[model samples]
Target: MNIETLTWGTLDIKDEQIYHFPKGIPGFEDDIDFALITVEDGPFSYLQSLQNQSVSFLLSDPFVFYPTYEFQLPESDKEELEIADLVNVRCMVTIKEELESSTVNLLAPIVLNPVKRSGKQVVLHNSNYQTRHGLWNVSQDHFEKGGE
Candidate 1:
């Protein structure tokens, strides 16, 4: 399918790349369908809304930055997404003017069930994580390991 995106122009994405967000992302509720465009050989991906060309979010695998980051997905959310065997988690990344100032949202992570092609942004209830964690705070070893 071809989607017109403000950030990447028109993109021909495979059907597997399209995810159905029944509840949508927190701020963009009406835009339910999104394409998960993964950047090759990196921990980054873009969640681009199919309903709105201008709506797009830069997402990063939080584990790449905070290896020890852990959270319990509410049973309700798991039920909503119909997650069973597999789950994919990615947080929104906010890029600032200064590269080092960029932050990734650890408070709310976008959870997806690839097998079912459904997703939702699950906000942690009692998490110590914040919305703005320094994107470059990780040690050089992380990057050297290519975020293993």
Candidate 2:
């Protein structure tokens, strides 16, 4: 499918790349369908809303920045998204601003069930993760390994 994006303009996204968010990303609840676009062979991916061309999110695999980043998805969320296996779910953190001065949201990771084509942002509890962790603080070694 050809999707008009906010940053990259119009591009082709396969059905497999389109994730169905029953309840869209917070704030943009009306736009439930989104496609994960890879801008580069890196950690960054743009979650472009299929319903709204101008709505998109910068997502990053938190594990790359914080090697120790961990979280438990509540049982409720599992049932909500019909996620039967943990391996079927992919996790990503929302990125804000440019890489040098930006921050990554770790407390609430977007959990995507690719097999089911469903996704949701699950806010964690009893964790040290924050909504904004300074990007500069992440270890260079971790980034290097992640990029590889």
Name the regions of candidate 1 deviating beyond 4 angstroms: 139-148
Best by lDDT: 1
Q: Put down candidate 1 lDDT per residue, 1-30, tens digits, no spaces.
A: 999998788899999999999988888999
In order, the Cα lDDT scores of the candidates are 0.90, 0.75
Summed over model 2, clashes come to 0
Global Cα lDDT for candidate 1: 0.90
Residue 54 Cα positional deviation in candidate 1, in Å, after optimal superposition: 0.1
TM-score of 1: 0.92
Q: List, residue by residue over 47-72, the lDDT tens digit for candidate 2.
A: 88999999888788777777776677
lDDT of 1 at 88: 96
Q: Give the lDDT of residue 69 in candidate 1.
A: 79
